[model samples]
Target: MGKLLENHSKNLLREAGVLVPKHVVARSPEEAAEKAAELGFPVVLKALVPVGKRGKAGAVKFAQNAQEAFELTRELLAMTVRHFPVEKVLIEEKIAIAQEWYLAITIDKKAQTPLIIASLKGGVDVEELSQSAPEQIMTKSIDPILGFAEFQAKELWSELGLTGKPLTLATQALTCLVKIFLAKDATLLEINPLVLTENGDVAAAASVMSVDDSAMYRHPELAAMVQLGSERTWRPLTDLEKRMVEVNELDPYRGTARYTEMDGGEIGFLCGGGGGSLLSFDALVSFGGRPANYSEVGGNPPERKVLGITKGILAKPGVKGLFVAHNITNNTQVDVLAQGVVQALKEMGKDPKIFPVVVREAGVNDEAAREIFTKTGVEYYGDNATITEAAQRMVERIKALEISGEGI
Candidate 1:
């Protein structure tokens, strides 16, 4: 899933014949003021980040005039919402709301079909609505093969106490939304506070959308809007994380290498397999060791791919030691992994003896791996040491260096 910025999601809704507020992107406070002026008085300004809950974070503000817009935009720009910086602001015309509603379409993976969830009680968290007034919410599952019908949408809104023109317009908007969801391969399409204006017109005041990355080849126009690999992280990608993404893309077909940097730690972490990586990380933490980054490299990756990820792990600011561990493998060549680690350490001018590099790899050509690692002065373990034991050794090695006053 690649989450689109709010400006992009609203544009999608607008193109689908669903009414959306006129909006523009402004990168600076001055630009925001200009955009607010163009959109007319009482404009809304929202941070252009991919995360949610902007209003709670003070990333959403209102401006009665251009001066207010400039100051508010400056405040939003200086703040970081949910770890994502507000590099740009979305300026839109404020709508006169008579009532608020919610509509969201997403897949129910267990049922393997599309699920529609809507509520008349909007402008509040859906979880709160579910807890406070369960009956106010309505849910319907649509058949993937047959598709959702307009009559079904109409019936849904009509049952929720909508009888007049607002009901009819909402039905049409929902029908269009479902069509857009299927056509665009969207994983989630949500319009919170889907407003019924004072003029008795239905419009999407805000939207949140994400599309399937696997199906991205079909939608070239969304390439600029969607941030790849964003679903894996909660916030914006760090510079090192972006570099790792590029490294993985360099050899897309051969193997996999994924990396994520932690907030602050001293030991570098590298492991093979998802389950093994989690296990290793837990083991490290349980033994009073802090890992600087998390990485998974497997599927018999070539040496260069392994090399790239290893170098990235070691390049973090506070990383003082290296820990490499993997589960017993059938296809992955331990010797090849050993070579990559050795080359990375050499190129980075790191001495394994003083750097506290520990390895616990076992399987396929273990003898060659042991020789390679031992020759380079790395503490290597084959089947003799458990993953837990390897982690403890890594922690002890770092402690020893610190006590000896030879810390790197």
Candidate 2:
């Protein structure tokens, strides 16, 4: 779930012996015009935002002279799209593309393998093409342990019907792309507009994307790049996220949490792991319940960490209900989690009668946790309860209190 900026993605491709267009980053219109003049006419001026679809958003423009370059840069500098402000512009020499194609390497979560996706049509939405005409796209999964073999890459090139130098270049590009994907531990590596130049030379006209936050540990350089981008954007990080990042630096082997704050709603979810959290969130949405935030107290988390996480979740405004759901696992202690929840409630000076809470604890020490909840007069569910059932019960309880006009 990590995303790399476009500049960094292009740098990775350049390091793999791919011929990318000569480019320069300009912080102002004057610098942009200078760079465009140095690179010659017909340069592309792109707004340097981390997100994609810049062309569709009018964030990318072409300049045939210095005046157009300056004007475009000035217009883009103050523009913001998708909540991201453009601070810099990339100026590059435009290539004469005779033909275009697409290539990408990414992990398939369902298949648990590396997937290679390519298409004959490029510079457009591949998803749209697939939906309208899937015959133009080619896809294959590769075993990470074996890496991508040369023969497999050759077969893919043949399937695309590319011949001669274009075929050779495409095969080489695929091989190098796979190497970069594996070497960087990237979740996604995409190259759109894998262009064939009018002179029959192959080059990458535009690199679309890449993301490799997991591999930041093994690549200090990549980690530095990530830090730089994060700093530039001035994104606000929650206390839990900052602490988790610090802990990850100290001990890379421990389980991690990906916490992001969202608009507050009625129910607060404390679910287990990624998949279970997503399931509960989707179920709550389907049952007409809005979640306050997405929080996953990972497996075997320390008691103090659990306490801190609970406190953080409860501190948000407009949280009327709480759902503590965990799947069947052997390591985590349910009693410890219960203690954290109880402590957080006490600190907030809130009464269970006013604030409704639902608990669905299963697995290790689940019985003890249920007993604790009972002693405190809190509602609790056992191991066999379905996720939908738990969500429905919470919604019903909240609705009842709403009907009564309770102050929660």
TM-score of 2: 0.84
How accurate locally, in lDDT, is each candidate? Answer: 0.89, 0.77
Per-residue lDDT of candidate 2, residues 161-231 (tens digit): 98888888888888888888888777777888788889887777777555555457787777645522222
Among these predictions, the greatest lDDT belongs to: 1
- Write candidate 1's Cα lDDT for 1-408 as tens digits: 678999999988898899999999999989999888988989999999987778887789899999999999999899888888789999999999999999999999899888999988878888888998999999999888999999999999999988889889999999999999999999899899899999989999989898886576679899899966555566777899889877776556677788888889999999987788899999999999989988988888889988999999989988889999997977789999999999999998899978989999999888999999999999999888899999999999878887888858
Clashing pairs in 1: none
Please count the clashing residue pairs in each candidate, in the order shown: 0, 0
- Which ten contiguous residues of candidate 2 have the minimum total lDDT? 227-236
